[model samples]
Target: MKTFGGPVLFLDRSDINTDEIIPAKYLTEITKEDLKPYILEDLKLSGFDPKDDKTKNARVILSRANFGCGSSREHAPWVFEVNGITAVIAESFARIFRQNMFNCGMAAIELPKADLDLIFSHSGQSDAAISINIEAQTLTMSGGGNQKTFPFELSPFDKALILAGGWVDYADQKY
Candidate 1:
């Protein structure tokens, strides 16, 4: 996608592993549709339930460092998309999970720590809209007459896959 923008949810924690994304019990399921109800189930323990009205409708998830650090299960990103998340912005991510996100068609954008902290700080305000421009490699945070743009990076291959709509779509066009 050229621009990732929408109502965002702040997953303020760090090192949120795969087991936490989909829970260990739901691992056997192969279809993203089948895994929707269970997305972010374990977040309930931490008092963040994705099924809740506002959270469930969130199109973006913004998190701190080491997000998706545990397992290499593709189901983690699968469940995210099934639950309506189109993109994820984080300061850092686990390698495998980052790859899985692209494979599953989710935009995983990385930003520097200072920028991430500012974004996190702004999450407290309701009705804010965040926009990320892929080509410019910048994030624009806007709300209530306040706006700021922060620079970010994306690899050429990763950027291409996301713009082409995930790995499968990218391969389909090339092959």
Candidate 2:
């Protein structure tokens, strides 16, 4: 897949678990897209509207450590995918959550501690823009006259799943 760029939705907070991604109450929804409305239900209580254009239009998610620590709910990444998040760049992600992202055809890039710190420092800025180069395995963060490119790690096998449009698509081709 070619690289894509978009405004960054920087969630400065950390330790965001699966429940925060999609509340358990909405997990029973027939489809993952149905859970999009509650992508960050907990944020609403903090005066953040999940339906706001900023959130809805964000294609890149920048968060701190332990991004998805709680449940292994696949719906978490599904919520992100349906909401237009093709890439998630964080300092760290729970093991299962990272896999879930790949299963959903979303890039879950784990940035080095130093690189993550740089990104976080620019959070909340009006011009925070980040581009993800799927093929090149690079993340370009630019805004406010600043730009930097950082390399992320992703196994070739897992990358294949994402480029092929998730596991099902890959399996279809091989089988």
Candidate 3:
């Protein structure tokens, strides 16, 4: 499987439900482009507008406990991937959400509370920099500290999907 290595951006929060990630109203749609504009809409205190924000490229998302804590919609992770979220770091995650992310070939890691805090602080700055090196299993930050690293459960199948550039691409390759 192909691996990811990059900086991280921390967002500190707990129990981020799937409905907050993507409301029920948008589920009728199939295109991820349609879902992109609404990601974290309910969670954003000021409302989220992707066009006006350049954080779209933030490679890693660090959050508090239970990051995806609601519903079983597959669309949750789909929206994240469509919007260019490479990895997610959190204290914990919902089973379905974690599986969905892995199925889609996105990396999800768990870190201690202290490590989570470092990334969270960066969100306030004009330039927040957090780095992730998957092969080395390390997270670096602007302040020069290391974060807790855990195993990512990438099955051989999941790795194939990521290496082939996502599920659809992998499906096409095998078929």
Candidate 4:
């Protein structure tokens, strides 16, 4: 399975739409690699800069509720995949987008609002990082001078999909 967790990109907002994740205009690009430079190009987060080094280096995304809230295309996850973002942890996700993430061998993790609030509290720390242990269903966030661990649960099928490197590979094995 693909390795997950590392330097995190914190998007402190809710209802981030598909268009903002990857503008619709670039969907025509022939290869996933072509979509790399445009990830979150249209996201209007207050302090976000898509061109910033932090954004480019982020291996996971931490966001608020309703992430991937618009459109049903798979391109959003594809953009993240090509950019080397293997996981997105949010308070909630648009159903289709969540499934798309798993289909692409990427994680779409949901934590309760209380847990998200606790995580976001550390957003100000530039060194913030998250370590996810899929086998244990735990997320550990650490930065500055503090660290905390939280528990999460995934269904058996979801776990299988992630372990098998997404739906395609899971199907290949099962069939």
**Over the stretch 1-175, how does candidate 1's per-residue lDDT look in tens digits?**
5347777888888888898888878877766799988878777445466668657777788888998998988888888787777788998999999998877656888888888888878776777667777778787887667899988788998888877878898888889
Residue 30 Cα positional deviation in candidate 1, in Å, after optimal superposition:
3.3
Query: What is the full ranking by TM-score, best candidate first?
Result: 4, 2, 1, 3
Candidate 4 stretches with Cα past 4 Å from truth are: none
Predict model 2's lDDT versus the native.
Answer: 0.82
Worst 10 residues of 4 by lDDT: 153-162
lDDT of 2 at 12: 69
Find the candidate with the highest TM-score and give its number: 4
Off by over 4 Å in 2: 44-49
The residue ranges of model 1 lying beyond 4 angstroms of the native Cα positions read: 1-3, 44-47, 172-175
Query: Pairing residues by index, what is the TM-score of model 1?
Result: 0.89
Models 1 onward score TM values of 0.89, 0.90, 0.74, 0.96
Query: All candidates' lDDT scores?
Result: 0.81, 0.82, 0.67, 0.90
lDDT of 3 by residue, 1-175 (tens): 5345444445556898899888999999978778888776666634234344544766567788988888999888878767777678898889888767766777666777775665666565545555555555565665343343434333566555555666776777678
Candidate 1 vs 2: which has more lDDT: 2
TM-score winner, 1 or 2:
2
The number of the candidate with the highest lDDT is 4
Candidate 1 vs candidate 4, TM-score winner: 4
